[model samples]
Target: MSILREARLSDLPAIETLVKAAYGHYVDRIGTIPGPMRDIDDHRYARHIEAGHVSLLFDNADGEESVDAGNGDKPVGLLVLIPQTDTLLLDNVAVAPSAQGRGFGKALMQAAEARARQLEFDSITLYTQELMHENLAIYRRYGYVETHRAEEFGLKRVYLRKSLA
Candidate 1:
């Protein structure tokens, strides 16, 4: 089974590590550091965790788990949520490279949706780099519709939204 929980202070380092490993591959593909890669760090994660904005995904399936046991439930995936007036912004969803293709990503996305509902949000919003076609497709498969496109921080982004109600 897999578990999703809000991050604690001790999980910041692992979160940062997982995020870097998850997003590092896109650096060369995008020809520049992805905004998430450049923006995420231990301090920021610490703040987010403290503010109740970060959640982590842990895979606990015996014999199928990939995380190290010594780390004490080290997270394989992460979700960063920012609550807005009427929506929950999924700022980031990342799965460690080693944990990709194991349904962890999809589970994390589902957890995000459940969280939005729990928080009384009517919708969820997110944006991905325009160059990351795979991510855009995955979000669409999750029922997120393209809301618009814009350039920010020198990168083209495709914004998407999904309604829960």
Candidate 2:
């Protein structure tokens, strides 16, 4: 079974590692076109965890009979969600490099949406670098529509939103 929970202070290191590993390639893959990806730093993530903006999702191999590969207690994936006045912003989503292509990102996002509704938020929002085509497509499939575009932190970012109301 997969579980979603609020990230605790202790999970900072793991979360940082996961985020960096998850997004570190974007800068290299896209070159300087989209500029840079900001969520790929360890200390940056530590700060997020300290500020209580991170959420964790763990997929226990044992709980999923179909997943024969065991990961012991390590988190296979994580989602960073920030709460706002009218929307829940998904700051980042990452799955372990060894565990990609298994729908972990999507499942984690679904949990985020549920949490947003529970918090009485009217919408969900996130921004992705133009270079991250796969991520943009995934968000689109999940009902997020492009809302804006900007260049932030040296990267061309496309913002997306989905109304829950």
Candidate 3:
């Protein structure tokens, strides 16, 4: 089972670590990290959490039907879903390095889609750096169609959206 919940102030530290770990390598490859990663002074994560825009998802280890032993309520992944004026934006999704190969990202995205549907959102959108081919492919596989392209924060990026209605 998986548990998805709104983020709390206490969750910021862990969330920051998760985000940095997930994107650090990509930053090195891009030659310049985006502001979210670069200018995040201590005040930022807490501010975002307070704004209620971020969310955390945990895998219920005890609920997994595996032969191996199970754990409980351990934070395995996270994502920030931002509600724009007209569209739902998937800001960021990061699975712990140890949890990368699992389907956590897909599960998180599915949850995001379900949320959009419940809110009557017409579309869901996101932006990914052009060099992040792996993420671009993942979004493409899940029906996100590219609508625009640009260079932002010194990295080429593609904007994608999925029409929900």
Candidate 4:
């Protein structure tokens, strides 16, 4: 079972560790550590947690497929959302490598859209590295359309957006 809920400040260490475990493998394929690995630190994670934008999707193996999972949530997924006037920016979405193929990532995406709708945003926007073909395809499959491409932090980025209405 998987549980999704807002992240607490105390989850900083777990968040940092999970982000690394989630994105570390990309360092070899992309020739650099992805932005999420470098960015998920105490300061940044704390800032987002305080703003109520960081959510965690925990796996409760002992539970019987429950959404809340009570208090037995374990390591799994992390999502970061930054609200803009017109759209919710998905700052980061990472799932622990060990937890892949378990639908945790998909759950996080659904959570992001629900949060965006709750905040009254019309759409969601996000960006991924140009070299991350798998992620791009998944985003497209989930209804995100490429808006443009740009370079930031010396890396080529493909920006995409999805309308909620």
**Candidate 2, residues 1-165: lDDT per residue as tens digits?**
676666776676666666666766775776753321354333566676777777777776567533211333567787777887879988877788878888788788888888789889989998888878998898899999999999876778899999998
Candidate 4: tens digits of C-alpha lDDT, residues 1-165 = 677878887777788888888888888888987888767643688888899988888776678665342354455998999998889999999998888997888999999999999999999999999999999999999999999999888778899999999
Q: For candidate 3, lDDT tens digit of each residue in 43-162?
A: 666776788877787777668533211222446777677788898888777788888888998998898888778777999999888888998999999999999999865768899999
Off by over 4 Å in 3: 34-36, 63-74
For each candidate in the order shown, give its overall lDDT on alpha carbons: 0.87, 0.74, 0.77, 0.86
- Residue pairs in candidate 4 whose N, alpha carbon or C atoms collide under 3 angstroms: none
Q: What TM-score fits each model?
A: 0.90, 0.83, 0.86, 0.90
Better of 2 and 4 by lDDT: 4
Model 1's lDDT to the true fold? 0.87
Compare the candidates by lDDT and give the number of the best one. Answer: 1
Clashes of 2: 0
lDDT leaderboard ranking = 1, 4, 3, 2
> Cα deviation of 140 in candidate 2 (Å)?
0.8
List clashing residue pairs in candidate 1. none
Candidate 1 residue-wise lDDT, 52-152, digit = tens: 99988888777454444246767889999999998999999999999999999999898899999999999999999998999999999999999999998
TM-score for candidate 1, please give it: 0.90
